[model samples]
Target: MPSRSFVVLAEQAQARHDGRVQFRQVLIDAVKPAVDLVYPPRCPLCGTAIAQQKGLCAPCWSELIIPGEPCCTTCQRPFPADYSEAAMVCGPCMADPPRHDGIAAGTLYNHASRALVLSFKHGRRIALSRMLAPLIIAQLPQLEGEWLVVPVPLHWSRLWYRGFNQAALLAEHIAKATGQTLLVDGLRRTRRTQPLGGLGRKGRERMLSGSIRLHPRKSDVMKAAQVILVDDVLTSGATSDACVKALKRGGAKTVKIACFSRVLDEARGQNTAMPETKTPEA
Candidate 1:
């Protein structure tokens, strides 16, 4: 018979095979029940009870507007359902392309998405950043590449009034979830402009021109770096244009705008038409 001491030692050695025991899983097993008991997981979109974890309720999920192809390859502008594939560039972009390399956006800036952005932006629903960040991340094809995750900065005045920069929050979450290095204060809004909501394209661009610049301290890192620019909404594309110009001027090799929502420019509606070689979904 084996000695009791040796048998006991063998048992301890077997138990000490730590690879067989997952510490994270053990912690989750012990803690999740208590956390769930006290605070249930509610739907991020509607705050209703959900059968599953980490997403919107079915109705809310269905309401999200995801624009597919047959859109502008450059600006990702949405065209009518009958638009053809041959016509990818919008009139504005074709006439004079944007200064930035390209754009990627999560969804159309319809009523549902607008409400979400407003809730997160002005209503202090900061938790929505985690929920909405995946939308922007989905649009990034170079997410895993060597890149800087940069957020459009809010001016100090606006930051004081808003209490937080929504773009930075989104960028942080994107970095956390994707393991990307985030440049939290990469861009600084040097000059504040009036709200650009109602401004025409030219007016918005003019207002934002020379308004943003690369952080002096971060200039070295930005040199020749591919950048993923995060923002809450792509409105007139003027702010993005200015920021991209600044990024390139600061020596960023490539700048791609990624936003949770993109405003479909109505001015380009007629100009986005293509020949009948490829048709959009009606």
Candidate 2:
């Protein structure tokens, strides 16, 4: 018979090896079940099951209007039918050139895209960022250089109330996809502003003016790096412009806007006028 001490040592060794084997098996079992149950994630836009991962279903993907030729060079907004692509400036960009050098958007802010954005931003569908980020990255193939991505910041009070920043979530995914550095603290909203959805172009511009500021320490990084400001939506381009202005003031060499959607002015059915701003009272 084995000595008692030798048997105890042998038993301890076997137990340790068994524990490691059991742990590995548990992990494999947990992951295997999930893998078997996996279907392509559903489209946030149409709720149709998508093939592969982080993508829209083929039909919905085909239906997506990737903004193409004849867009505004500076803003990436679709230009009027008669506008020339070589013009380099749309009427709005010429009239009031944004502080940013250019813009890139994943899709037109039309009915389908609007549904998706609203679901992700307000419905707490945080997983939608996984699909949205890849689409945005697909549109920005030329995105290279010493780039820093900064999300449009939400006020601390609003973030606390909402429990997340949709833009920040989107930015995180983009940073992960592109291997670009995310400078989350680069921009901030000093005051809470009313949602700009129903505001007229001018009203939206006024509301966002001077609302964003850059951190003092990141001025050196801003001076040295190109910046891409990420946001969930673009309406009247006011928020992006405000962010660009602040980044430029902090010495950013160039600033560009990248958003998931852009609201079209002409799409409002009969409600063409600006609605009253409903800011929360302090």
Candidate 3:
């Protein structure tokens, strides 16, 4: 029913649009090599020059401790000796089961991972999400069904001060990487609590007892849903435990804690106290 002249004009416009898009891409391709020559990519962590961008140097990469199988089924901590069984829970977990399903950590807390955490959190290196999210993803177990990616919420006060939630940033990347739905406001902080550093497990528990809860609007979606609760670091297991409890109360079928770094008791020489690195309140 349309006129032939109108059809021809529309086709011409589309061809022009496609040509512009191709020209823009060609320009970008041409400029990228010049930009790389002027400013070569370097290691994000150690500042050592590297062949590619957003990659770590060999020495810095080696310093990171990536935990693998032969780990506790509940906490995912590597066992002391090689065990034949496919699944094994540690003695501590056997004695008292954890509320959350399990923990998947990118790396064990160490000097190298510590620097990454510090820069991502306090230094506001938001771009690091692209580099850091993959580490957590590599450690994540194969998720069966649809899983919701939820970041541990930041208090309004802290969120306002920092201008961004590092966990949420990581969750955004994780959701995209895994093709999972992201619920940025799945959880909410009830109030701002004191810095949880230097606190014992019991002390941290008390401080965070009612500090986190499910966002009211997301309660329906959370019901019986699988969730990946994200955080930058896992220390003392107190904050993460609290978040898990909140998700469980919201009827989340299984809530797995995924983090960039995990502070392990064995890594701490079995000391109960946390290390000197700064720990942000959950």
Model 1: how far residue 132 lies from native, Å: 0.6
Q: After superposition, how far is residue 192 of candidate 3 from its true place, in Å?
A: 0.3
- TM-scores for every predicted model: 0.77, 0.77, 0.85
Residue-pair clash count for candidate 2: 0
What lDDT tens digits, residue by residue, belong to model 2 across residues 1-282? Answer: 989999999999999999999999999877864664675456666777654335667776676667876777777768657776495667777887667787788887665676677677667778888878777777674766668989999888888877888888888988878889999888889888877857667897798877789987787788857888999877677777788889888888877787887666565543332221222322
Q: Which candidate, 1 or 3, has the higher lDDT?
A: 3
lDDT of 1 by residue, 169-217 (tens): 9999888877879999999999977777555789988888888999999
Sorted on TM-score, best first, the list reads 3, 1, 2
Give the higher-TM-score candidate: 1 or 2: 1
Per-candidate local distance difference test: 0.79, 0.76, 0.87
lDDT of 3 at 139: 91
For model 3, the superposed segments whose C-alpha errors exceed 4 Å read: 1-31, 34-39, 269-282
- Ten residues in a row with the worst lDDT in model 1? 273-282
* List of clashing residue pairs for candidate 2: none
Name the top TM-score candidate: 3
lDDT of 1 at 223: 86
lDDT assessment of candidate 2: 0.76
Model 3: what TM-score? 0.85
